[model samples]
Target: MATDHDIPSPCPSLRDRKKAATRAAILDHAERLFEERGYDQVTGAEIADAANISVKTLFVYFRSKEDLAFADTWLIDAVVDTLSRRPSGTSHAQAVGEVLNQALRTLNPDSGGLDAFHRGFGESEALRSRLLRMWADYEDAIATVLAREASLPAPDPAIRLAATQLIGIIRSCTSDEVREYVSGFPGEETDALRGWIRQAVEQVDNGLTRFLDRTSQSPGI
Candidate 1:
């Protein structure tokens, strides 16, 4: 007899498929328009028209134009999920690296998706502000995970600093400056960037491990 766990899950319903397709179409049209012109120049209504959807429907899919442009909530959730369930022996940095590596592999560097984002970032204060808020959220999430794993009363300075440093490394690597510089390379050089980021993370991991060991052995932790 087949157990509950042995049975395959049901596929998505037609409504779910249509909703997902609509969302994807909105993103596709929005990105293309943003890239061709500038993010600031493209209106949400224009995006809706381009996607062959009503402006009202566009709002249903995405709350705002900024929301449409910076839609990576899945990545944030994935990071938290991975950190929460990582093996006992795996370092926090290692778990983060695993998620990042998978994301990088799936990314198409030549797609120019990030071009508009970076350009808008440089041109618009709103974008720069949004970017900072996004990074802060990532830092806070990391710090929370670190605190939870350590069973700390709260996120201490060391834990917060370590989380900041890890996110900083990621932010620096993905900065508009690095992207422009890497654009000159023969290929996308994703491997080179990935290797460099890994080394940085590993170094931080080693330092964090040593610090934790020392603090744990001290009279007052």
Candidate 2:
């Protein structure tokens, strides 16, 4: 009784296709629902009915509401991929600097999808804590890339501490507070945000240079 466009394929691959379709449906419903009702407020049962999927099916893609809470894992994977493809001889700090620049630039509130995500995040505390934890993962991922590039004997505590410091600059220096400045003065008159970013980058650069200098200094003590 359905039209040609309405009829789904009868093949076995159609089952797999339908599974993927259902998964996407669940994610769409979850994202919107979490944004609407607090991430903790929305239940899997509510999402299942909303997305027109069985609760079991929703579990197949996501373990918990927290899974849906921070659904932009793909963005972090993209960051890792970008570092993987960096030119051959890049330093750990420079590679992170470039990646941070790209990542920060991608986050302009004028940009719609992620901007809306920012709004959603700004409202959720549980989500905010998890998001804060993700910054460490982001830095560690970059540090691993740098370690492999540098052929370190043990890329542990040192690379991790260094990466954490670099990421700290980006995270702390350019914060949600920057958005206030951006909105208040959207014109060229306000250099506050840009100045903050420059200062953070320079501090990281200087710290990195100092660390390398200490490493290279003749040990005559």
Most accurate candidate by TM-score: 1
With a 3 Å backbone cut-off (N, CA, C), the pairs that clash in candidate 1 are none
Candidate with top lDDT is 1
Q: After best superposition, candidate 2 residue 154: deviation in angstroms?
A: 4.4
In Å, residue 50's CA in model 1 sits off its true spot by: 1.9
lDDT of 1 by residue, 1-221 (tens): 99999999999999999999999999888878877888888898899999999999999988878877777576668778988898988877787777777777676775432232344323666777777888899999988987887788678777788788767666766676667665665575676567656886787787777444524645442
What's each prediction's TM-score? Answer: 0.74, 0.67
The stretch of ten residues in a row with the least summed lDDT in candidate 2 is 109-118
Weakest 10 consecutive residues, lDDT, candidate 1?
A: 113-122
* lDDT of every model, 2 decimals: 0.74, 0.63
Error of 1 at 71 (Å): 1.7
Residue lDDT tens for model 2, 70-176: 66666557656765776755644455556545554666534431234445534566667776777867787767865775576555555666667666665653366
Question: Which residue pairs in model 2 clash with each other?
Answer: none
